[model samples]
Target: MSKRTAILQTAAANTDAATEALDLALAMASMDQSVQLILASEAVNCISDNPSKRYAMLELLEAEPILVFTDEPLSNPHQLDIEIISSQQLAPQLNSYNEVLQFS
Candidate 1:
C-alpha cells in the first residue's frame, strides 16, 4: 500500500511541459498520494522568485515537496522553497519511491 511517486522534470526550455507535469502531480496528490518532484539540469530554471512565465508551475510546487538538483546554478535560487541535493543523493532517494514519471 505504498503510494510513493516521483515526478522528474529536466526540460527547462519548455515551460508548458513543466506545467503539465506539475498539474499531473497535483492531481495525484489530491488523491492522497505521496508525491515528490525533482527539478534537475535545466529544469531547475522552471522556478523563479518573481511571478513570471513559470509562475503557474511555481505555485503548484508550493503544494508539494520539491527537490532541486544543485549540479547547476539556478536563475533564482531564492524563489522557491526547495531541498537542494546533489546527483549522488538523487539516485538513492529516487530508489525509495515506488513509481517515477519523467517530464523531459
Candidate 2:
C-alpha cells in the first residue's frame, strides 16, 4: 500500500489554496495511495466549508487508495478522517508516510 501525507493550511481568506489542496488531495486518491490530510491554523476553514470539502475529498479517496483528513492526531479512518490537530502531532504523523506534501 502506498502512503501519502498532505498538510492543507488555507485560512478562510485563503480559499484558493484551500481549494487547491482539496483538488490535490483528490488527485492523490485517484492514484490509489492512502492519504492523510492535515488541516491546521487558519486552514481549519477548509474543513468548515458547507457540505464540507471533506466529502469531495473522499470522492477522490474511493477504492484501493484510502483517504483521511484530520487536523488532529488519531487513527486513520477507512473512508476519510477529519480532525483538529497541532503541528507537533503533524510531524510524527507525516514521518510514517512514504511521501509527504505540504500546501500553504
Candidate 3:
C-alpha cells in the first residue's frame, strides 16, 4: 500500500482555505495515504465548537484524517483521531509525514 501524510494548518474565519486543503487531503488519503490536520489560532475553533456546518463537510470525506490541536480541546465524537499537541512538539511529529501542507 502506498502511504502518504499531510499537515494542514489554518487560522482563518471563513475557512475557505482550510476547507479546500481538507478536500485535497481527503482525496490524497482516500488512496491509502495517512493524513493529519493541525489546528492553531482561530482555526482551532472548528474542532471544539460542537457541531458546525463545516464539521459535516469534513466528516463526509472518504479519508478520515487524524486531528491534532495546540491548546485546543478535543470533544467531538466524530473525530476519529484527536490529540492535544504543543507548537514546539508539532514540528518533529510533522516531519514524519511524506508531505506537509500549510495554510493561513
Candidate 3 lDDT over 17-77, as tens digits, reads 7677666666665554566666666667666665345445444554554456565445666
Q: Which model is ahead, 1 or 2, in terms of lDDT?
A: 1
Model 3: runs farther than 4 Å from truth?
1-3, 50-65, 72-80
TM-score order, best first, reads 1, 3, 2
Score residue 21 of candidate 1 by CA lDDT. 74
TM-score of each: 0.74, 0.60, 0.68
Highest lDDT among the candidates is held by which one?
1
What's the best-to-worst order under lDDT? 1, 3, 2
Encode model 1's per-residue lDDT on 1-39: one tens digit a residue.
767889998877457777777777777766667787788
Query: Which 10 residues in a row give candidate 3 its minimum summed lDDT?
Result: 50-59
- The C-alpha RMSD of each candidate to the native structure, in angstroms, is 3.3, 5.4, 3.2
Ten-residue stretch with the least lDDT total in model 1? 49-58
- Each prediction's whole-model lDDT (CA): 0.71, 0.53, 0.62
Q: Cα deviation of 27 in candidate 1 (Å)?
A: 0.8
User: Which residue pairs show backbone clashes in model 1?
Assistant: none
